[model samples]
Target: MAATDTIFALASGAGRAAVAVMRLSGPASGPILAGIAGGLPPPRRASLRRLRDAEGATLDRALVLWFPGPGSYTGEDGAELHLHGGPAVVAAVASALAALGARPAEPGEFTRRAFLNGQLDLTAAEGIADLIAAETEAQRRQALRQADGALARLHDEWAGRLARLLAHQEAAIEFAEDGLPTDLDARARAGAAALRSEITAHLADGRKGERLREGLLVAILGAPNAGKSSLLNALAGREAAIVSARAGTTRDVVEVRLVLGGVPVTLADTAGLREAADEIEQEGIRRARRRAEEADLVLAVFAADVAPDAVTLDWVARGAVPVASKVDLAPAPAAIGGTAPLPVSALTGAGLDALRARLAEEAARLAGSGDAALLTRPRHRAALSETVAWLEEAESAPLPELASEALRAALRALGRLTGRVGVEDLLDIVFRDFCIGK
Candidate 1:
């Protein structure tokens, strides 16, 4: 990462394609592009050019782009070479770049430089990563909002207020020493309290953003022969789990991912919950209980034709969705576990549409569609929590000087979230997960 050394990397996905994009950024980007592409093109314009090696041998005809300094993605001289997507062509161009004194970029170096040059903040940078990794439309929308500076704007607003408070606290300390009457101290404390309340409210978003980012986990639990596996297969629209008439057929958890209400859900069909005599069945039951406890939502199933087991009934009492499976076999009870069961027949495909709709509704409730600027990472939560604590200390501090110090600490925490300040230690961590050439 020598600032003076030009770096180049394949910005496009690695595979044989029609064209491969080679991105270059650094002080020598223009010179390196000229050396290999025969000469630089008009700034920000792409032109057809013959790429040649130092030996003056033609490598390939390609599209060459030259983006001159102070206006490019990294705010430095940069260029991109769209070359034929062939291993030999890529290798020859890479060799030529090295010969021209340009090295390969490290992971996230491009975006890291963008952040260093103030193109975007840390939260927005993370949003870029999320956007690239998004698997659903809802996820893409949320990531796009964050990348468009939604979270950054919110954090910057709070940071501005915190800075003002610190300034007022300092002013109050100076004015008191000079025996001047001023309400600066009271104003600073009041402002800190208000900001603290706002941050607290933001932190209480039910972790919808995080849940959307990571996806939701729903576990199906019930006694043996309760049709949990059948329900899972029906919901997945595939034979995802082996079915059996015998009890304890599924000895482990079977999981499948599906989108419900635009939220990705990992639906787990677990072993029946019961006191088992077999050792393997006992382990399966243990895992089933553990999965149920850890799940974001639970589907406690009971057969319409059989008596509901108390173990699963307890789960239903604790807010699990009660489902009456095999509805074709017998009529569902008026109520089970204090609520009306969702009558469904997995074998006959009866009531499955309603069941899916119900699951989608629950998924939306558990993990929101994330229309608001929500915190998507645990790091955001931790930083905001720390900021809130510091604000509380600032509010209660007896001395204006101490209060100012607390405000400074709070500002540092907020700055870490948006990479405005105090983020040198986090750069590696933040960018390490990024793909090379980002």
Candidate 2:
């Protein structure tokens, strides 16, 4: 789709850097540079030049770069002004471009234009947004892979298989009376079942990828004086929360994020659970329970001095791992430390390494079995889930006609993922999240 107007924005981050870049695109790109910088650079070339305004007023001695249409990012003619990194200088250049017929690029408009011109597919484009928003190293790497078309490639592979299978099904259904090989129907059904299995396994991976992209929420829960505050501070590696041996010191839930094995995991330390006269402490306890249930993992912190009791029992009922804190103090109750319950002392740093390793292993497991092709966004997961549902239905179907319909529906959903079929609504929402200069 060719857009009518040109757009421009400060491509470089706003800061006191030595130089800043302002990007322009569309029909007016060449003219805009010519008006401000005397002349345009050759395609993909940068030229030294002095920039000026409409009235021949000197703005800044800047480097100008140009790219011709149909090949550049945005698949349109584009230009860049490497101007001095000053707010006023950048603003003057932007104003000059606007006067020369370029409008301010809306957030993500540059990438949006790139998408419009087929420079990147919908998933890759969204991957750009995800990459920009990534919070941890693993998130950055994962988003970068998606931005490089990992999901797109996987989807294309499945789509191609389904397309071939659909062809066979259609031929069998359409020419059955011509003494078509009787085994064609059976073969088609078997193929549908196999494809359904593939999609089912693929969609199952969506949960872990989503969790890794968003980071897992972990809650640290226990009665007051259970070393919850100490553990929070210890895990954070900084004094994010006040820590003391005094009971009920932390009256509110405190959150901290740390990278465990390249995965970002959030830890929440909640107020100690107890019969309390303080309303604030009671409120904290209530919030703690709510967050504990929402947590991807809950750490039931109890000092070795305390007995294995109802508080830790409730968490175990919901599949939480009971973590025995203060292993340096004394031996924990025999009931608490079994084959799975990990013990650590956030005080003396005893067994903390083992705890961290365990948490990382769990995060990795939840994030996927290391190499499963994961859907990085909710949109991808939703599409995959819908497609997987149909695949399941198709697998159980005996009639080739019903199975073929289900297979077609599944193929259509996968098609929407890679833009082989139009996803205008999805595209609109996805591109809307981008920054103006991409």
Off by over 4 Å in 1: 421-438
What lDDT would each prediction earn against the true structure? 0.89, 0.79
Task: Tell me the spans in candidate 2 whose CA falls farther than 4 Å from its real position.
Answer: 177-182, 244-246, 334-337, 368-372, 395-402, 422-438
- Over the stretch 28-135, how does candidate 1's per-residue lDDT look in tens digits? 998888998888789888899999999999989999999987888888899999999988889889999999999999999998898988878999999998999899
State the local distance difference test value for candidate 2.
Answer: 0.79
The digit string of per-residue lDDT tens for model 2 on 117-140 reads 889888888889888888877777
The prediction achieving the highest TM-score against the true structure is 1
The ten-residue window of minimal lDDT in model 1 covers: 429-438
Measured with C-alpha atoms, the lDDT of residue 405 in candidate 2 is 88
Deviation from native of the Cα of residue 143 in model 2, angstroms: 1.5
Predicted candidate 2: what Cα RMSD to the true structure?
Answer: 7.0
